[model samples]
Target: MAKQFPEISPALQEFILRQRVFFTASAATTGRVNVSPRGTDMLRVLGPNAVVYLDLTGSGNETAAHLRATGRLTVMFCAFEGAPMILRLYGAGRVLRRGGPDYARLLATEYGGTEPLGARQMVLLDIDLVQTSCGFGVPLFDHAGERPTLARWAEAKEKQEGLEAYRRQKNTRSIDGLPTGLFEEDPVPVG
Candidate 1:
């Protein structure tokens, strides 16, 4: 049976911390829903009702664009090598860019004052619902190691031109013509 709670409990937090990967979903008011797989030790549980994850530079800025249009977001984690279970966090989230105060504060607090190579922005999820379900059908899989290609690419690009230049070319707009708020001089305010 699936169970839902108001917020994450201590036990639930433990499970969340151990997950090797998670998926984030978001959608604009009318466009397609974007679901992206995210991994790396890039997430942190801030409180019983809040969590944050470091979002690296990606091909599409769908999540940030979607959140700018609609605050709805869902983060899901499934056990591939553990007790059979699935966890979902439903929340409203905001994107904080690298230059923002909230981003700096959170980074310092949770991440020990250093940023990742392709650090883009941090997505904060103010979770309102935590759900757990039996994952009896979720196939088991073994863990591999993290991929270094992204970091290598980001490093090479930064060394060649600059991070801002790449962001301007690739990260400025979502596929749906929505602004990503990346590299913006005066970014659009979050609604």
Candidate 2:
């Protein structure tokens, strides 16, 4: 069975909170589509129609670059432990650079002004569609806890070249050569 909703219902929000991982999909008008697995407790549901995730430094900045080229983004969550359900949120998303207005507001209100290590930017999605489907075929798995590898890497990198420099070197462009807007935006250090 499948269902669609105009906004995120309370039940859906609870389901989202319970999940330890989610996937993000994005693409420009041309080139390869990007789908990436994300975790690390960086996402927040602000309201029925809005959600945001802290974008950490990674091998590539495809999502930000794709969002800059095209506002469309999709986030998906699946029930791997409990009920058999899959959720998808479709929306127009935008990148909130480190010093941007939306980023500042969200950081203060939702994040308590604490920016984690390796945080490059924030992606805010104004959701327009919410869909849920049966995940009966999906295999069940136990939660093994989040990995500390990324945090440790970020700490070491911050101690070395600094996150900003790393972002400049690796996160400025998508694999298909689209600008991620990181270079154009002047990001101030978050205290």
Candidate 3:
């Protein structure tokens, strides 16, 4: 049976922490709906009603753009190893750009001041609803390991065109023409 909660319960938080992979979904008022699989040790549950993830640089920045346009976001996690369960968090999201106070504080306090090579921004979700369901139809898979390709690419790119330059070139706009707010001079407000 599926269940829902107003906020993330303790058990749900533990489940989120154990997962190695999660998926994010968002969409602007128009255009395509974006759903992306995300990995790496970059997500954190700040409280019962809040979660944050370090969004690495990618070929596209749909989530950031979608949040900027609409503020609606959902994050889903499925158990791939043990129990058959799926958890989804529904919320409003905001991007915390690099150099912003919230970004800096989270980097310092939650992440030991270590920023990943291709980190573009942090996405904060003020969760409104938490839901769980039996994931019996989902196939289970064993964890192989983290791939080093993205990290290597980020390092090389930083040495060449530079990560900031690359962001300007590719990540500033979504495929559907929405601004990603990546390079705005003003800091994004966070709550």
Q: Which candidate leads in lDDT?
A: 3
Q: What is the lDDT of residue 98 in candidate 2?
A: 85
- Cα displacement (angstroms), candidate 3, residue 156, comes to 0.5
Worst 10 residues of 2 by lDDT: 182-191
TM values, all candidates: 0.95, 0.94, 0.96
State the local distance difference test value for candidate 3: 0.93
Cα-based lDDT at residue 181, candidate 2: 83
Model 2 residue 35 CA deviation in Å: 0.5
Off by over 4 Å in 2: 185-191
lDDT of each: 0.89, 0.90, 0.93
- State the lDDT at 10 in candidate 2: 98
Off by over 4 Å in 1: 186-191
Cα lDDT for residue 89, model 3?
96
> Model 2, residue 122: what's the lDDT?
92
Q: Kindly provide the TM-score of model 3 when superposed on the true structure, using C-alpha atoms.
A: 0.96
Q: List the residue pairs that clash in candidate 3.
A: none
Model 1 reaches what TM-score against the true structure? Answer: 0.95
